[model samples]
Target: MPKSVAGGTKWTYFASSNAQNSRSPEVLFDLLVSCSSEQGFSQVAYGALTDAEPTRRPEYLPAAVTVNFPSAWRERYAERRYNAIDPVVRRTTMQSAPFLWDQLAHKYQLQPGEMRVLNEAKEAGLKHGVTVPLFGPFGQLSVVSFASSFDDVDPEYRLSRLNALAWQSHHTFAEIAPSSEGKCHMKVALSEREKDCLRWVEEGKSSCEIGVILRVSENTVNFHLKNAMRKLETNSRTHCLAKAIRPGLI
Candidate 1:
């Protein structure tokens, strides 16, 4: 089914998944880049949040898989461990919506540290862009971001289109990339709120009902469920219930 998204964007659920199943992520990523080329995005980067290595570093920071971003920025980001302050990277695990870089910067009121990171990024020609975060079923997190030199970009229309395309690329990547152990080598830890949501889910409560019980927005309930799924490392709700039960979580 082709569903409507923000700004009248159309998403064909099966189309994105089926088209790139036969190919490699590298190939599929390049294919998406080619499509976005028409809109003047010269660079793209897809990062797997599962790459974080908090153990060996002086400060804990998640590593990433980046492509097409500027080499200078990449080096500096690592050297300074900027992941601690980069708003976009921090939000992907918590937020379901796609975010424009500047929007987040303002929302959090970019402190001096955050602003320095953004300033460096801007100097590297990554001044404007949108990041789409994807939470995979098996407790994995990834993000796809498109960057361009143009500052006068239209976020509403552009982000709506790019957000869908980013998911398409992500679904393609999941098909190709095998799960690997991280430095943590531990399962994702669910928050107390997520546990509450799962417990109600086990009791057959709908998301809306769960929201009412929890006194949060319906969307917040979905967010908690998605995060719980990522932590539980299961695609099916039934399987998640079983896994959580076996572990005595729910």
Candidate 2:
């Protein structure tokens, strides 16, 4: 049964049974649509970015995308290459957090161009929205957005429920999505030195401190950490530590 949040919005938490049914992209998208509708959102979109470089322009037509937005709006967004300027997309690369569109102006100093994108979206009937950003193991990024035409929705409750749904959608899609050239199954074997550096990093040690403990130069410690990141296909030290710890590699 769906639970009702404040202001009578029905929030559907995806149960394990529901997850089992969402094995295909079509089923996953349908689940998003149904959940969005139940929560008073008029549209839902899911996009995956193989390259999440904030400075680079994303492909106008993303390779992995599904949406229930209007065709005309979609055309406009693509034609204008709005993804490159969209504050939401930029924010996704900077953090792994779910946020409401209405909060963007408060959290970020919106440039004129970014503000224009938001205005155009509202003109196209996407007045309010929540977005969930998911980071992948190999520097990929996936985002799910639920948008509404009205402004009266409860932000806190809806964001919490939709955040759960977005994560479930990401995991289910990852399981069924095609892997390219064994990328998904590749083993990440860290060298002993790399493991040692990552273990020290996990304990909140600085590169200089790790160098002293390992009896190596700070630059050498950094080199091993970078090698570990390359093997793990992560971009940052924090992400590398998380990837290493998750599989008990360190």
| Local distance difference test scores for all models | 0.61, 0.68
| Count of backbone clashes, every candidate in sequence | 2, 0
User: How would you encode candidate 2's per-residue C-alpha lDDT over 1-250 as one tens digit per residue?
Assistant: 1223211122123323455455556665676677667777858887776563222124335744577776789899889989889887777777667888888988999999899988889899998888887677556677778898777877656775566556545554555555521123568888999988876765556899999989999999999999998987766675566455434465
**What TM-scores do the predictions have?**
0.58, 0.60
Which residue pairs clash in candidate 2? none
lDDT of 1 by residue, 1-250 (tens): 1223221122233324455456454455557676555556667877767653111222222444437677778778889888888877777777767788778766776678878887778889986878887665456667778887777766556765566566544544444455322112345567788878766665556789989999999999998888777776655443354344333454
* Pairs with steric clashes in candidate 1: 52-62, 52-63
| Global fold similarity of model 1 (TM-score) | 0.58
**What is the C-alpha local distance difference test score of candidate 2?**
0.68
